[model samples]
Target: MIPKYRKQFNKEFSDEKYSQLKGILAKKGGIEPTFRISESPIFLTKEFESKLIDASESIISQIKTLPAEILQKAIPDNCRVPNDTDKPHFFTIDFGICRSENGAIEPQLIELQAFPSLYAFQKVYEETYCEVYPFLSEIRNPMSHETFKNHLKELIVGDENPENVILLEIFPEKQKTAIDFSLTEKLLGIKTVCLTKVKKEGLKLYYENDEKHTEIKRIYNRVIFDELDNIPDLKTEFDFREEVDVKWITHPNWFFKISKFLLPLLKHQFVPKSYFLHEFPEHESLENFVLKPLFSFAGSGVNLNPTIEITSAIKDKENYILQRKVNYEPLFEDINREFSKAEIRLLYIWRENDEYPILLENLGRMTKAAMVNVDFNKKDAIWIGSSNAFFG
Candidate 1:
C-alpha cells in the first residue's frame, strides 16, 4: 500500500464527497447499495500487486492438475451436487498480511470461494470511485468495463436471447447481496428468479416473464447448497440432481469441488497450514488455529478464538477445517495515524475456453474489528467496509 497518496486522500477527504460518490453509484442502474461503502479505496504498490497475482496464479495452476479422485473425496458422499462441470466459473482468493518468522510482512491466504460474489456491483462501484477522484485514474484497473461486459455476454447469454438466461438465487430480494442481482439484471438484461419460482416441466425449466412462460436455456447460479437445507419445506421443482435440460454458467458441483474443501490440498508459501478438522489428530494446540465451517459464507461460522470444548462440541468434523490463524499486520492507514488490517479479495472469471481463470477485479476491506466485513464494523468509522484500490 502507498502511504503518501493515502495521506493525501485522507487530508482531502470530506463526508460530502463520500455522500456524492454514494449518490453517483446509487443513480447508476437506479439502485442503492444495501451494504456499507468505505470512505477510502486501498492503494496497492507494484510490489504488493505482483505478489498477489503470483500467489493466485500459482494456486490456480496447481488446482488444474489436481486429481479428480481427491476432489471427489473432499465433497461429502451424500451432499455432492449433481451435473458436475469440474471447473468453477468464478472464484475469489482472500489475502491477509502477516509477519513472517524473519519479521517481514507477507500475504497469507485466509480462504477462497468458488462461488460468485458481488460480481456485477463491484464494477459499477469502481466507476463511481474513479468519478470521485480523477487523479487516481493512473492506477491500473484489474477489470475493464468492456472486458467484463463481453465476458458476461459470452458466459451467460452466449448465442441465446438475454431474457432466456436467468440468475438463479433463493429469495434474491431478501438477501443482503441482492444489489448485485439487480445490477446484473440492469447491465446484462437478464432477469433474477428465485429457485422456488422455476417451473420444471418434462426436463425443461421455465420462469414466468410478464405473465408469459419463457424457456430457460442457461442458468447463472447464485444459490448455495448449504442454504437449501434450511428451506426444505419450500415448494419448488429445483433439484441439483434432477438432470434438467439446461446449461449452468457456473455449475453447482464446482462450488463444492473448488472451495474451502480444496484449501487443504493447496500448498504454497502464501497459504497456511490448513487441515480437515475430522482428520486432524487431537491435542493439536488449537489456540493458534481458527475453526471454520467448510460450507458457510460471508465470514459466517469462522472462529478466531476457539475453545477446546467448542471444537469438541462439533458433531460434524468433516464439515469443518482448522486453519492456522495469520497475524494480520495493519497495512492501510487511518485518520488517527493507526492502520487497520485489511483483507483483499482477488476476483477471477473463467471463460469456457480459457486455459485459466482470468483476474477480473478485486474487493478490499480495511477494518477496525477482528474481521473485515461491513457487518463487523461501523459505517461512519475511519477505515472499514467495502473499498477499492488505486494501483499506480
Candidate 2:
C-alpha cells in the first residue's frame, strides 16, 4: 500500500464526500449496495503488485499440475454437476497482505474460487471512487473498464443473444450482492433468473422472458452447492446434476474442484500450511490453526481459535480443513491513524483455450474484525468494508 496516497485521501476525506460517493453509486446501479463500500481504495506500488502476481501465478501453476483423480475427488458424489467444462472460466484468488516471520511485508493466500465474483460492479465502483477523488485517477486497475467489459461480454454472452444467456442464481433479487446481478444485466443485456424458475422441457431448459418462455442457451451460475443443499425442501424443475442443453459459463463443478477443497494440495510461499482434518498431525497445536468447512462461503463456519475438543467432536472430518493461521498486518491507516486488516482478491478470467487465467482487477476488503465478512466487523465501522486496489 502507498502511504502518500493513503495520507492524502484521509486528509481530504469528509462525511459529505463519502455520502456523495454512495449516492452516485446507488443512482447508477438503481440500488444502494447491501455491503458497505470502504471510504478509500488502497494504492498498491509496482513492487507489491509484482509480488501478488508472482504468488498467484505460482499457485495456479501447481493447481494445473494436480492429477485428474485428485481434482475429481474434490467434488462430492451428490454435488457432481453434469457436463462440466474442461477448465474454469472465472477464477478468483484471495490474499492477505501481511508481515512474514522475518518482519517483511508479504501476500499470504487466504482462499481461491473458480466461481464468478462481482465482475461488472467492480469496474463501476472503482471508476466512481476516482470520480469523487479527482487526484487519485492516475492509480487505476491494471485493465481498463472498457477492456474488462468487452472481455466479460465475450465470455458470458458470447456469440449467442444476451437474452438467451441468463445469470442464474437462487432468488437473486433478495441476495445482498444483487447490485452486481443488476449491473450484469444492464451491461450485458442478460436477465437474472431464479434457479427454481427454470423450466425443464425434455433435455432443454427455459425461463420466462417478458411473460413468454425463452430457451436458455447459457447459464452464468451463481448458486452455491452448500446453500442449495441446505434448502432441501425447495423444489426446482431443473437439476444441476441432470444433462441439460444449456452450456455453463464456468460450469458448476468448478465451484467444488477449485475451492478450499484444493487448498491443502497447493504449495506456495504465500500459502499457509494446510491439512485435511482426517490427515491432520496429532502433534500439531490446534491453537495455531483455524478450522474451516470446505464448502461454506463467506467465512460461514470458520473457527479462529480451535481447541482439541472441537476438532475431535466434528464427525465429518473429510468435510473440514485445519489451516495454519497467518497474522494479518493492519496495513490501511484511517483518519485517526488506526489501521485495518485487509485482504486483496485478484480476479481472473480464463478463456476457452487459454493456458492460464488472466489477472484482470482486484477486490479488496478492509476489516477491523477477526474475519473480512461484514458480520464480523463492528456495526459503526467506516474505514473497513468492501474496497478495490489501485495499482500505479
lDDT by residue (1-392, candidate 2, tens digit) is 68788878998899999999889888888888998888888777888888899998999899889887888898999989888777899999999888999998888998999999988888888889989998888777757777888999999999999889999999888898999998888889999999999999999999999998999998998998668878769999988889889889888889999988987888888899999999999898888899999989999999999888998899999999999999999888888888898889988999998998887778989899878776678978778888888876
Q: For every model shown, what is its TM-score relative to the native structure?
A: 0.95, 0.98
Regions of candidate 2 where Cα sits further than 4 Å from its true position: none
RMSD of every prediction:
1.8, 1.1
Cα lDDT tens digits for candidate 1, 1-392: 68778877888788898999889877874677777888789887878788888899989999889998877776766567667776778878899866788887678988887778777787887888878877666675856798888887787788899889999999988887777898889888999999889998998999999898999999998988667778857778868778789998788777777788878888899898888888876767789888989888788888988887998899989889999888888777876777877878888888767889877778887788888766888555677888876676
Which parts of model 1 have CA positions greater than 4 angstroms off?
281-283
Clashing pairs in 1: none
Record all residue pairs in model 2 with backbone atoms less than 3 Å apart, i.e. clashing. none
Error of 2 at 73 (Å): 0.3
Question: TM-score of the candidate numbered 2?
Answer: 0.98
